[model samples]
Target: MTTPDTQSCTACQDLERGREQAAAVRDRSKVTDFHVLIARHRARHPAADEAVNVMREQGPRT
Candidate 1:
């Protein structure tokens, strides 16, 4: 099965766009900006659900 990012979906494109925006403003990104980026990324890429869910279950990495 194709992953969301590899599927060339709109959301995936949006995520890439977001990343670009973040990179463009890297020095200005605040805590809230990071949170927003993560939230948007998760919202746009449901196909990542399996991996994300598994990670959530596994807890934070050291």
Candidate 2:
């Protein structure tokens, strides 16, 4: 049986992983905000900026 402490510890580990990945991406490319990443991707990938902006406007859900 899983204890509440174990559940909390798992949640914290998942959150830490997410944060670490975000940090790694930012450190590798120097982009933090989603919108900035979208813009950079658009420039490099030559995708539509309007489409990227729309996706970016979705906020944290992106």
Candidate 3:
């Protein structure tokens, strides 16, 4: 995933799905705006900058 902010345009025909996830994630945002990206990163325990950096160095998300 390229981050929620990048994917917020959404990828679904179901308006309900978009609205639900959108509404639920509204408060988990960050100052720089990479909410979904950060979320995916954290899912892999990459809250540490080094991990994120390493992942990036090797190219992330295939």
Candidate 4:
């Protein structure tokens, strides 16, 4: 029930979300990527460089 254009549009949307999240993580301590929220709790906020690694390890939650 999906056309090629529909699939392409969905991919583009996902890419934008990823770019936005990357910028957010780089420039701030909070991120709202997908359902996983990353924030600076107390003084243990993750560094910008560690953001991607952290997210990869955490992955998606069911």
Candidate 5:
């Protein structure tokens, strides 16, 4: 399940997909790039950052 904000955020979806693809292929550089992009996104969107922190606290979804 995705939050309403996440579902509506194309940039977030794209970055996550890019990161997943990079990780699947063991492309550390691309993965790092996506992480950087996500960090930048979070810096600009405090709500998103907070959501991520909450999710982290909850741990991984099963």
Candidate 6:
């Protein structure tokens, strides 16, 4: 059963993966594309997006 939490987690994981791959190849265009996608996702799910933005601002946890 795919719940909202799972769906949100998957979206976050996919975006993070895309970001890492883009960075690995130093592909500016792809990175920009991912940024666009992320923005759309944030618009669609502002609450979930807030959690992500907070984590991003705080940096990775140790």
> Which candidate achieves the best TM-score against the true structure?
5
Task: Return whichever of 2 and 5 wins on TM-score.
Answer: 5
* Model 3: per-residue Cα lDDT over 1-55, one tens digit each: 6443333333322333544566577733332244455455446642345666887
Per-residue lDDT over 14-50 for candidate 5, one digit per residue giving the tens place of the 0 to 100 score? 9999999999999999999999998898576657667
Give the clash count for model 2: 0
Q: What does candidate 2's lDDT look like per residue over 1-62, in tens digits? A: 43333243444445445556777767634324443544444354343445568778987883
Candidate rank order under lDDT:
5, 6, 1, 2, 3, 4
lDDT of 4 by residue, 1-62 (tens): 43333243444356446658777678433334432432222123334336557878889955
Candidate 2 colliding pairs: none
**What C-alpha RMSD separates each model from the true structure?**
8.8, 14.8, 10.8, 14.4, 10.8, 11.6
Model 6 regions more than 4 Å off: 1-8, 48-62
Worst 10 residues of 6 by lDDT: 1-10
lDDT of 1 by residue, 1-48 (tens): 645444656655665567677677774555356557657776755656
Q: Considering every candidate listed, which one attains the maximal lDDT?
A: 5
User: CA lDDT of each candidate?
Assistant: 0.62, 0.50, 0.47, 0.46, 0.84, 0.76
Residue 43 alpha-carbon offset, candidate 3, angstroms: 0.2
What would the TM-scores of all predictions be? 0.34, 0.31, 0.22, 0.30, 0.63, 0.58
Model 1 residue 1 CA deviation in Å: 17
Worst 10 residues of 1 by lDDT: 2-11
Give, for candidate 3, the lowest lDDT window spanning 10 residues. 4-13
Q: Would you list the rank order by TM-score, best first?
A: 5, 6, 1, 2, 4, 3
lDDT, candidate 4, at 51? 58
